[model samples]
Target: MRSIEDRSSGTSGDDGSSGDSIADAAKTVEEQPAFQAVARGGFLMGGLVHVLIGWMAVRLALGDSGGSADQNGAMAMIAQAPGGRLLLWVGGLVMAILALWFLLRTWFAARRGHEVKAAVVDALRWSGPAAVYAGLSGMVLRFAAGGGSSSSAQTQSATAGLMGSGPGRALVLLAGAVVIGIGIGFVVVGVTRRFLRQLERSGALSVGAALRITGIVGYIAKGLALAAVGALLGWAAISADPDRASGLDGALTTMAGLPAGVAMLLVIGVGLILFGIHSGLRSRYQEM
Candidate 1:
């Protein structure tokens, strides 16, 4: 019979080996060419969405009452176009795949033998993109199914629900703060040109100036938009008015009502388009 100490040691070794095997498998799946291709397609799909949203924003600024200037608006616009539903389905699938890839990356990052703090940070970084892509996938699928609702309406409804309770209002406030933090992060990334770290050096250098310009403008615009969104949410919580929490569409609309808001919207719209262009480039040049 084996001694208890010896058996315990063996069990520990087995567990360690099992963990290593799982990590290795995850890394292998991540390295697959097909997976990378799907992820790149996801990036392209996201870029297309951003471009559409920007166009809608321009239309809004130009006094076109065509659609809401947000993701739902973009999807609605796409749905109206020829073969749009099919495109939405495909894009939804790709986004789902990309989200899965990000989750895998999060797992890999956590198990990379880094210090606990570093691993946690790395995992958090990957997880944010995972959550974003997953949300996008769901939105795309919802529209692809010919069943969708206004983002602003959904936002207000949710905010109203949360505001109905004290703790819920606090949660909403927390969420707003988190969004603002994310927006600030985007600005920092743009200003610092930190996004280039995810691209292939040679590929990034090929269109260096254009990439840099678009990336900077796009990030700042996105950051500003997000900040406005968070601020609106916070306002809604404070004033107990859910209508104040209308999301991106509302944020833009509110900007439109400000003095020189049209020009600001136009700049933001153009910047978003540039960001979409940057995303397209990233799809091609991103380090898998």
Candidate 2:
């Protein structure tokens, strides 16, 4: 048999040098300013999306009823606008970049020699948003390819399918609960002003009072909207009525149907717009 050094050397080929190359490559990519810019652009695109969706929700609140008040609705509006397709293309590209950026961030964090549990949690945190960014990128690309607009009807249909079977129905209920939990987490983040930690300290401090106000209001509104969607989905699961399940569009509409519902929707709409503005600033000020 070979000596220990030979075995170790052989093992390096299988598990060491290539891994170092990947980590080095990740570090190089992370160091590039252009990559950072693309990530920022992706954040800006996300902000613009929120702004558009909020505007649509506001319109619906005012009784226009012209379109859905969600991401798909926002895509439709963008497609109709001058140079909308170009915007979608650019946004989609940047969002894809953002997803990669998130992965890089997770990798860097995991390499910090932190406790395994903490690193894993951090990885999961980054991964959730990475998945979201990836999904948004796909949606933008789909619209650019003339795949047509998004609709909450799709959500309802999926919910209906889930409710058709016992196992599926249980999964739907679990999903709704998870959504609610996410919404509550958002609320906690907002109320506790934890989001500011994501921004560069100097940049965040320089933005002043408006940023804080917007961040707080925006997060709360979004949290409430998500909670409403989750509640609706749970209700649908319980009632065996998939039609009762909806996304943001449905949630806001349901709010509109309640006492002072129109006013509530309008408020939520404004809150969403504020969130968009906050997101836009974050694109510039994020610590990366």
- Winning candidate number (lDDT): 1
Worst lDDT window (10 residues) for model 2?
1-10
Task: Please identify model 1 stretches exceeding 4 Å from their true place.
Answer: 1-11, 203-206
lDDT of 2 by residue, 90-170 (tens): 999999999899988877666555566677777877887789899999999998898954456877877876888888878
Model 2: residues with Cα > 4 Å off, grouped in runs: 1-14, 203-206
Question: Whole-model lDDT for model 2 versus the true structure?
Answer: 0.84
TM-score of each: 0.92, 0.92
For each candidate, what is the lDDT? 0.87, 0.84
Reference-based TM-score, model 2: 0.92
lDDT for model 1: 0.87
- The worst-scoring run of ten residues by lDDT in candidate 1 lies at 1-10
Spell out the clash pairs found in candidate 1: none
